[model samples]
Target: MKDGNLDSIDKRILYYLQQDARRTSSSDIAERLDLSASTVRTRLNKLENSGIVRGYHLDIDYDLAGYPLYTKIICTAPVPDRDSLASQAQEIHGVTAVREIMTGERNVYVNAIGTDHDDLNRISKDLDALGLEIVDEQLIRDEYVCPYHGFIDEGDDPAPDDVDEVETE
Candidate 1:
């Protein structure tokens, strides 16, 4: 979030990784960009140190892995401090993600994934009691699960009986 730090090569390296983290290895990046693997590794390490590359993650299908619920809760209120409110929200169990989104009036968006509706309800209650007034609370009923395309949901097809869908265990 600084000004004029990223050079052209740095931006290209970032874009390559962002497109497909697993597909492109350090060697592949070096080969494509015409640099040695050690150079690429150094740059990647720098990016990580600088906080540009936050973390690498693998896409997982939640529903197939026995976590089918994707619940999103939107809360609105006049808070004394934004950072403290965010921290408190994250403290609540089952709160996978919390973000302060400013669409029209400023509000906090809560995204939680639960194994069932009961778990989601518990999380909802936690959000309510977090000292923030609720403007809206809506469940993302149709949970989308895809490794590549997030918007295109694979639908409510139950996991195969014989197949055991495991996460990154």
Candidate 2:
């Protein structure tokens, strides 16, 4: 649903899930939040049903897995065809993910992994065949990801001094 619909409990659940969905079970979260396991499960169900918690994805290390090449191919597509083209790009052999941007000439980004330059070139050609103009391709070294900080419970409300500072501002 919308951001406004999420209460503190829902945000905390999201925070824990983001940290490690596979290792962190509802029971684990329940223990930490002092909530019932059933409540955590129900909240997770609601999040998933509302499309907020889309899916738990694997953080794959292609480099360690024998695919030593990772690239992000930025592309430009006809505005009307951007979404479809991005979706179709995923069908290319090396493509791992595709994203559609809302505003810009280079509106589609394709993340692909390959064994070598040849494999990446093939993926690029496949994207071209789908009518996306390859703007540029960059080799990705590493990526860092973490939970949204705003979802974290600081365990204490702001002090009166902090509130006074805000009022002064």
Candidate 3:
């Protein structure tokens, strides 16, 4: 919490354990931050041993679980074959994610989900037979923005009319 620097009560115990780590309890985040349920279990075990609390996920929905076609394949190769083509596009069958883009012109980026558009064109012909050069292959017309809203001022102190005050050129 010192070098990692998440001060304000460890960002309010990671904004109430990212909004519900299994029904949020460290005595319900120490009674909503008045503190002490053993100091929110010692700062949620030092935010899970300083990895800044990494493992609690389960949003799913993948188009209501029927895998509603959301491809995005962007590939490219030969920079030493980009980590063996992102580890063979993570073993191929409906690759959920494989990003290895060190910086543009597509070094590899895959996110797959199927059951339509001919199962995303058979995962874009299994990523173009893995020789890697399929520069673009879109299809996800909707995830407007995500990150599922976790960290934004759970640490507070900005709202004095949302601040705006300097005047002395």
Best by TM-score: 2
Tens-place lDDT digits, model 2, residues 1-169: 5745898889988877776788779998797778999999999998998899899998888899999999999999999998889889988998999999999898999999999999999999999999999999999998667667687558744233322322110
Instruction: Locate the minimum summed-lDDT window of 10 residues in model 2.
Output: 160-169
What overall lDDT, based on C-alpha atoms, would model 2 receive against the true structure? 0.85
How well does each candidate superpose onto the true structure, as a TM-score? Answer: 0.73, 0.89, 0.33
TM-score, cand. 2 vs. native: 0.89
Task: Estimate the TM-score for candidate 1.
Answer: 0.73
Q: Which of candidates 1 and 2 reaches a greater lDDT?
A: 2
- Expressed as tens digits, the lDDT of each residue in 93-117 for candidate 3 is 8888788888766888888888788
Query: Per-model C-alpha lDDT, please?
Result: 0.67, 0.85, 0.73
Model 1 steric clash pairs: none
Q: Which pairs of residues collide in candidate 2? A: none
Candidate 3 vs. true structure, TM-score: 0.33
The global Cα lDDT (0 to 1) of model 1 is 0.67
Best-to-worst ranking by TM-score: 2, 1, 3
